[model samples]
Target: MLKVCHMTSVHKRYDGRILKKECVSLVNAGYDVTLIVTDNKEDEIYRGVKITSIDFHPKNRLDRILNSKKRMLKKALNIDADVYHFHDPELIPVGIILHNKGKKVIYDSHEDFVQDIKEKVWIPNCIRIVLSFLFKYYEKISAKNFDMIITVTPHIVDKFLNYHRNVHMITNYPVVNFEDRKNNKRSDCNQICFTGLISPLWEHENIIKALNIMKKDDISYTLAGPSDEDYIKKLKDLDVNKRIKYMGVVDAIGVDIIQTHSVAGMAILKYSQTVGGKIGTLGNTKIFEYMYSQIPVICSDFVLWKEIIDKWKCGICVNPNDIDSISKAITFLKNNKLEAKTMGENGRRAVIQEYNWETQEKKLLALYAQIAGERVL
Candidate 1:
């Protein structure tokens, strides 16, 4: 069996994309996979993938770049696997080092780092510009050394293609299994749901503020997944009649429950074209999850995202920043339950037919095949 080592300095060991999808898929495909992550601990096996660690969690952003990089690199070198896959922008140098040791290094680009840096609110305006330029150059220079580049969306692929030829577009689509949820009908549910990174990048506040605009006592909102402690406090202080409830960090089944119970899903990424802003147009996994759960969606009005929503006819794409648009969409979905139900079914059908992880699985295995010399590179 080919030994594969996946590394991450940021996300936890069982992160959805790294563990649930990629590592698990590799194991099913007959590769011996091991994931290297932070938190120095003994290695163990979870779902046939070995999990190892560096036992390091930095206090701040600066520590991750200034300190965690070296320690994680040392752990990676000690693993000595045939193929090294790393996630995290700061690990670009780590990937290069492994590549120099003659290992097939694959860089997983999940986000546009340069864009993210451009939108970082904490960084000084002058410094943010400098950091964005430095990171843009560094990302390109480091990515060119990798054997292959695995990207989560076409947008990221477009960015990476300018740097490297071997770019694989493997989206972070949900594990499309809607058979069990087919018979589970929920017609009049008034709950709206959102799970995943509940941060400013995801426009968490936008979702809450939209709900605030629609003063419907009957409607309730459920949010799961971890967010900053300070942000959590801020949301708690919102006088939204205690209708907005945060369920804290939830597991896979927990997230599914929220989606199933919700009448409509919220995926309102903030509309921003600034340098470090979040890529609002990429594949938002939560939308697909809501579809798989058979529900209408209220998402941002980005051109790429609107096109998908229009093609599927499953939800309303609104100006996320426009309180009236979001409020109107939700109010419509709540009042016109039948229309919302139809939209939900259309979304589920779309997920079952095309936007499923199983389809992306083929792309992933094909990339590994090329790596293993089982197919032409």
Candidate 2:
């Protein structure tokens, strides 16, 4: 078996795409897979992927960026794997180092960095433009040295095509077990849920505010994910806290547990989408997750999302920016439980047929096969 090592300086050891999905998938496909991450200091194995944990507790964001890359490079040099796949943008320089050592280096572009930089709320508005420009050019120059570039979306692949020679678009889809399709059959729960990142950039605040306007006092909510301490505190202050149950940080199983008892999902992802024309096209991971879990989604009515929702008849596409529209969508799902249950079943069917990780898994296996000079599956 060909040895493959995936390194991530920015993300967690169990990042869904990089580690859990990519590394775990590779392991099942008969590769000698290993993962290196910055979070955990103690090394261990879970789900067949061997993890090489590094101790790097940084004081601040800058320390993690600058220090993690340096530490990552030092540890990466000794791995000596046939292929080194890295996910962090900050690890671009390290990729070049591995390439020079006659190792196949793959850069996984997780996001459109240009747009991400523009949407970075922490970065000062004045310098964001300049930083975005410089980062784009820098990535372009660094990516040229890598063997292949694996991007999360087609839109992101376009951004790298001119810069990198070998690039592939691999959409991140939720891993749904079609065997347990019966479990996904929806029933009325009088509850709604939101899973994953709860941030202002993702318009999480809109969903919270909309709940206030909702007429249904009996409805409770479950928020299952990590959040900034300050922002979490702000949420605690909201009067809706009595109805909204915050599950702090939940694992995949925990999310499933929440979804099992939930009726609807709120997916208001609008980061880098505030512009009038730039509506999301590729779709968010949470949307697919909600679909697979057989939860009717109440999400932003972007053009692309509307196209998919209309075709699938899976869920309601609402104006996320307006609290009234969000509340109305919630009420519609609540008052009409049978309709909501049917919509949830439609969503699960959509996932089984077209939107599950199985399709993307084939693409990933084919890519790795090509890299290893093996016959494409």
| lDDT of candidate 2 over 122-196, digit per residue (tens) | 899878989988987888788878878988655667668887778997877888776784555445587889888
Per-model lDDT: 0.81, 0.80
Tens digits of lDDT, candidate 1, 1-377: 78899999888887889999999999999998999888766778989999987878778777877888788788777777888888888888888888888889899878777877878888898999999999888888887689999887667787889979999888878886545657446675878888878887666676677778777596887889888888888876773777778899998788777787777999887766531233454545877888888889898777766777899999999876787788788889989888888999999888898888899889998888889883123
Q: Where is model 1 poorest over a 10-residue stretch in terms of lDDT? A: 274-283
Question: What would the TM-scores of all predictions be?
Answer: 0.91, 0.91
Q: Tell me the spans in candidate 2 whose CA falls farther than 4 Å from its real position.
A: 184-188, 216-218, 236-242, 251-253, 271-277, 281-283, 374-377
lDDT of 2: 0.80
How many steric clashes does model 1 contain? Answer: 8
